[model samples]
Target: MDKLALTFELSYYLWGLLTLTIPIAIHLLSKHRGKLVPFAHIALIKVKNSPQLNQARLTQWLLLILRLLMLLVACAILAQLVWSKNADTSANLVLVSNDWLAQSSDAEKQQLFEDLNSSQNSRLFIIDGLNQSLSQRKLESKALLAFQGDTSSTTTPPLNIWANLAEISKTLPKAQKIQLYTTNRLNQFTGQKVAITNPIEWHIKSLPNTLPETKLTASLTIVSDANYQQQLLYVRGALDALATTLPLDLNIEYLDSSLVQEDLDLSQQQSHIIYLADAPLPTELVNSATSIISSEQLQGYTQADFPLTLATKLFAAQTKQWFADNARLSNQQITELPNLDLVNQQQTNTGNAQSLHLWLILILVILFMTERLLSEWPNKHSRQVEGN
Candidate 1:
């Protein structure tokens, strides 16, 4: 955890070890004094027998002292009193799943692949190539060739982002989590606002003078019949380059089996536009029909500087992917994702301080009661003197 916690834990250990000495010392001293006998040389020895030195009294004191020491040692062990470096020997494996649906272009996909490949000891699973099953197969090891064009699944499957994530989680080493890369599409899911606990870091190369917030927008139109009557429709959002083009009056049906029609039209600036017609759609679809048409390229989103709307979107996508992978099995498990070290450190320090305070109070109370008992002890000599 933190230095504070480390210090407190060490101190408790010291206290525990030291406390053991208290009972041992008391036992040794008590055993030695137990042999002391009263001599008949009364002229040289005028000291009176103290109440604390009686055999029964000494035995009682020794028992109490030893009991206290035992309690202290027990408490320390439960508190993790030892300073250890062995805990760090544990290594964690995180499986990262990347899908082609989220990639804006070939170049973007390549860049994303490069990022994923660069990670240390990560297993990559690519889901878009020639052989459907083969393309979706998980890749093991660090070979660079396996990452480029495996001639796998040609058809892009419906984005089963969560299910794919769950598969990755099952493949990963137990106790390790699977990390899914998703866009800012989470807002459509959970209605709650979002915060950036952990934001992806990107060092974009060959970007077209685009700021982190740069976004491109496209409008789609739907025509139901020859009369151009509007109807319920579904729309998917996605992005393409400036030069890339799609055919006009394109006919595409939604996966929900809705009788919707979409037409791609060029904007005044020659940008692609999506048109929908006779769209039989449901408003409460699980996945967002709206695609990440304009993937907002950015440097980074931070906990302090990121917008709530964007954070919500990113959180939704990431969290959804996380759950699909069964990685969120510990969703209720302390999710201080970004600042784990800081949070753990704080908790450990607090626990140690509380322990120390409790022990100190116990010691003080014992000492106070011992002194009061000694002060009020009865005098045996005075009783004998009065009777004579």
Candidate 2:
């Protein structure tokens, strides 16, 4: 049997719904202050002892509705209200990958598709290495009918879908359970193993199969000035330690003290360069390097042609000055790959509901402007009539 329910992504934001009363208060205040004030005509006009409810005309209904809609939308956005077929934590959200489907029989694939398509209680999503939930909108349109899953590509790219179910779940409204139908690839699970507090219930489609693998390989170069040799050794040792943990082909090179950033070999396939200096690195090293030298940092906002980053501190046990730099370097290098982000991810609601809020706020602003115009229409009409 199919189940249906509506849920809020951020139930906490429902508290903002209390603000709806503000518009009502404003409407009442405006009416109370609409009391007639006369000077020359005061002698002819009689002041009523008791104000009647009918005395306050109700012509601003459109304006009131517009203002009310703005508040309602704001509250809806804050609440992140979404309609879920099943709101249970146990509700199954199945993320299917291409590799898993490839190993299955045609009959089995058809059955899986029919079952998911028939069930209103579960959602079927398509996933691959480079994309997650390829046809989210398309799936919704089809009434969420599951097939073996859609073809995500012309060629099945090598996949390392490590904890991909957990990532997709984070983006979805919090549910009781999630499952990934995939083959076990070691690359999918290469990140540091920590017990997931809210782990995805992994459902293996078949025994693990080996996919074509890619290694993180980079050549490193260091300034060979005698003054920085000791620090350079620390950097080398740290790089080697990082290299051992993954499939990395590392090559080392040296730069003379007189060598400038322009002296760097631009044609080399090395992905990164390290500049060890007492001062900041020159910008030209980024140009001569085939590898992008920039990282996601904000020291200097200069946009370089290649990925460049100002060299960060590399701490060794021998140096008591800064030991945490080792951890930073390790983390930065791993992020150049996948799966590591999950191990380091701080547990929070994974869905980005900000876009929801943004769209609602935009509508609310438009409604506010319309409401203002509506409220002034009567005044404008009155002025024109008096002038005629």
Candidate 3:
């Protein structure tokens, strides 16, 4: 059996339905009354009922009904009624975290695939750290192979599983079951716990102690002249400290004259360049390097804290990449879950609303034309009878 759900976009417009009483009041108040005629004798006059009288009475009732229907349809249009059929309850929606797929062994992957394939109505969705939006795909062998590659390069913050579930549940039909397949790594759960409106069967795979690591390498060049020799020492010290802690390589260069073609070539090879001179960097070098920091940036820092400040700035720039390489999985354990009743239930699909609007507009037009014709029909018939 198909279940029907009705929703209103502008619910306040439903107040217009109160106007339907106006036509009914007019119908009762404007009832046709016979006029008084002066006569010499009561027996001299014979009362004869006109055939058009019955037609007029019938038309009056029809017009009232038509007017009431027109008002109702108009109110429905303003309210923007949305009609949707609930999806099949037997169908299953499976959400798989990309982090789990990246760390899971081949045997585990095969077992998961077999379990989902056994359920013919199951649909698959992959949730990755990079993209928060859900992308639906078929549960096939080839599709599973595509997700096997290293996702660490594109990793952002830890995946917020509860938040994603809260958002995705809004679009799904009520009573439709959802199954979530993810790892039990605590680092992967970063955000605050959200209310789970939909009941989700959790398939948490325990992660191993050691996960795969991603290594990052970059070339850094520091160019300084005699004028900024003192500042250069602090910058080099900062670079040395950064090299030990971060996966970075420093290629220090000191130039007294303007950068030549060879200097530009070296700059091209380096990923980032720090220019600690008064003169502006050459347009060629600026365009060749991925990022360039000028001496003007060192204005606020005192000489005493210059090395620490410089190191902090450099680390901040590469924080995202550092997290990607080092923090692949967290060691924390999940102790308790959030309250499910707090999940937000009010969810709407834009596509369904738009399609419903188009349909209602068509019905409104047809009702309007029919009411106009019915309103004029009684008058036209009365005139024909009087002429004859």
The model with the greatest TM-score is 3
Of the pair 1 and 3, which is ahead by TM-score? 3
Across 1-388, the per-residue lDDT of candidate 2 in tens digits comes to: 2345555666788888788888788877876655667578569776675332322254455666787798889888777765444335544566666556655566666666776767667666656543534344224414323434433322334444544544554555444465666555332333443333344655564333233244444555565466667655655555655556545565767666467455645336444555555544555555554443322222332334111222232212112212221112222232233343555443445344333556677888898888887677667867896999
Tens-digit lDDT string for candidate 1 (192-277): 22222222222212112212121223333322343222222112212111213222232333222233312221122222212232
lDDT by residue for model 3 over 100-147, one digit each (tens)?
A: 788677777787778777887767887664344454433454477556
Instruction: Give the deviation of candidate 1 from the true structure as CA RMSD.
Output: 16.1
For each candidate, the alpha-carbon lDDT, in order, equals: 0.36, 0.52, 0.67
Give me the displacement of residue 214 in model 1, in angstroms: 23
Residue 319 lDDT, candidate 2, scale 0-100: 27
Q: What is the TM-score of each candidate against the true structure?
A: 0.28, 0.38, 0.67
lDDT head-to-head 1 vs 3, winner: 3
Error of 2 at 3 (Å): 8.6
Best by lDDT: 3
Determine the backbone clash count of candidate 1: 23
Better of 1 and 2 by TM-score: 2
RMSD of each: 16.1, 15.4, 5.9
User: Candidate 2: lDDT of 52?
Assistant: 25
